[model samples]
Target: MRYPEQYLQFIEKFNEGEYYECHDLLEEIWMEDKSDKFLQGLLQLAVGLYHRECGNIKGARWMFGNARKYLARYAPSRWGLDIDQIILYIQSCEQALPDADSIPYAKAKAMAFPSLRLLIDQS
Candidate 1:
C-alpha cells in the first residue's frame, strides 16, 4: 500500500530512536483525519517511546496502553506494519517497567529499547 511521505519519515525517525521527532512527523497526517485509528495508534506509540526515553514512566505506560487499544482493531497487519509485533513490543516495554510509579530513572534508562521496522515491499 502506498503511504504518505510523513508516515515514512515517522518510521525512519522511529527506527533511529528519535521518538519525539517521529511523533512530530506523524502528528500532521494524523490530524488530517482524526478518525484514522491507525495513525492515532502510531502517534501514541511514538509518544509512548518518547516518554519512556525521557524517564516519564507513568506517561509512557499510559501512552503504550492507549496505543495498544487504538491499534488492536487492525491486528496482524496494517499499512506494512506487523501490528501484532508492535503490540508485543509495547507489552515487553511495559513489562520492563512494570511498576511505573516505583521504577527509578536509572533503571528505566538502563532498559534496552527495541527498534521497529516496517515491512516494505520492494516489488
Candidate 2:
C-alpha cells in the first residue's frame, strides 16, 4: 500500500505529546500496508508510547519488545523516519520501565516520547 505524500499530521500529534492520536494516525497506514515491517515497528512504538504515557506498563512492555525486534533489521534512517533514533527512544523507555510502572506521564521522564517526521527529499 502506498502512503500519502506526507505524515506531518502524525508528527504534529506526536510532538504535541498526543501519543494516542499518533497511534491512530499511523494505524491507518499500517492496516493498508501489513507487509511493511517499518510500519509495524512504528505502530508498535506509537502504541508503546501511548501505553507508557497512560500508565499501562503491561501494554508498554509488550509493544516496546515488539518494536525492538521489528526495528532491529533496518538502518537508522529510512522512509523519512529516524529509525535508530526511535529505537533509542524506545530503549530509553525500557530503561525507565521500573520507574514508570507505577507513575503517570507527568512523573516519568522516560515517557516523554519524541515526535516522528517524514524526511524531505533532497531532489
Candidate 3:
C-alpha cells in the first residue's frame, strides 16, 4: 500500500484531537517506513502534541525540536499537507516551552494545543 492503514488512522486521530492515539498510529507507519522523512516529522509532531496535552513540557519540547529537524525539509507543502502553518505553530510551541516549564500545572494546562491538518487535493 502507498499509504499504510495506520497512516489513515493517524490522520483521523490527529484531526479528532486524539494526539496520543495519533502518535501511536503514526508510529505504526513510521516504523515500517523509516525512509520517509515527512512521515518521521509528522510522527514527531504528533508525539509533541500528545506530550503537550498531557502536561509533559519537556517531552513536548524535545519532540518539537526533533520535528523541526525533519520538517524543515518540507516547509510550505509536502506529503499532501499545508505545513507552513504547522511550522509556525511549532515556532509558537518553542516560544512557549520556557513558560510551560516554569508555570504551575494548572496554568500551563490552559495553553492551547495545535491540531494537525491535511491539505485536501481537489485535483
Candidate 4:
C-alpha cells in the first residue's frame, strides 16, 4: 500500500522536531485505517517522539525501538523512512543519556524533527 501524502507530511513534521504535532497528525491516519503496518509504525514513531519531547524518555525509547523494528520489515524506500538518518538520531539520543530522567525535554526538542506542524496542517 502507498503511504499517503498527508502521512508523508506527518513524517516531515517528525523530521522537523514537532513531536506533538507529529503524534496528532498521524493519529488521523491511524484512526481512518489501523491495519496498515507502515502507517502504524509511523504513528508509533510519532508517538514515541511525542513522549521524548514530553520527557518520557523510556516511553520514547520503547516506541522508537518498536517503530524501527516494525519499519525494518519493509524497505526504507518503500516505507518512507530515512533509515540512516533515524539511526543517527537514535544513536545520538542514546549516547547522551545515562537514564530516562537525565534527558531534558528541551534537549529532546532540539534533537527532534522540525516539520511536525506541517504534518498537522496536511492532515
- Highest TM-score: which candidate? 1
What is the Cα-based lDDT of residue 30 in candidate 1? 84
* Tens-digit per-residue lDDT, 1-123, candidate 4: 566676777767766767677767777777887766666666676787677667777887787777766666664434535555554555555554446553776776576342323222222
Q: List candidate 4 segments past 4 Å from native.
A: 1-3, 84-92, 101-123
RMSD of 1: 1.9
Over 4 Å off, model 3:
1-3, 98-106, 113-116
Backbone clash tally (model 1):
0
What order do you get sorting by TM-score, best first?
A: 1, 3, 2, 4
Order by lDDT, highest first: 1, 3, 2, 4
Q: Which RMSD values do the candidates have, in order? A: 1.9, 3.6, 2.6, 5.4
Question: Please, what are the lDDT tens digits per residue for candidate 3 over residues 61-86?
Answer: 98998888888888777656667777
Q: Pick the candidate with the highest lDDT.
A: 1
On a 0 to 1 TM-score scale, where does candidate 2 land against the true structure? Answer: 0.75
Error of 2 at 41 (Å): 1.1
The TM-score measured for candidate 3 stands at: 0.79
Estimate the lDDT of model 1.
0.83
In candidate 4, the residue pairs with backbone N, CA or C atoms under 3 Å apart (3 or more residues apart, or in different chains) clash, namely: 13-115, 13-116, 15-113, 15-114, 16-113, 16-114, 16-115, 17-112, 17-113, 17-114
- Clash count list over all predictions: 0, 1, 0, 10
Each model's TM-score, in the order given? 0.88, 0.75, 0.79, 0.64
**lDDT score, candidate 2:** 0.71
Residue pairs in collision within model 2: 80-119
The count of residue-pair clashes in candidate 2 stands at 1
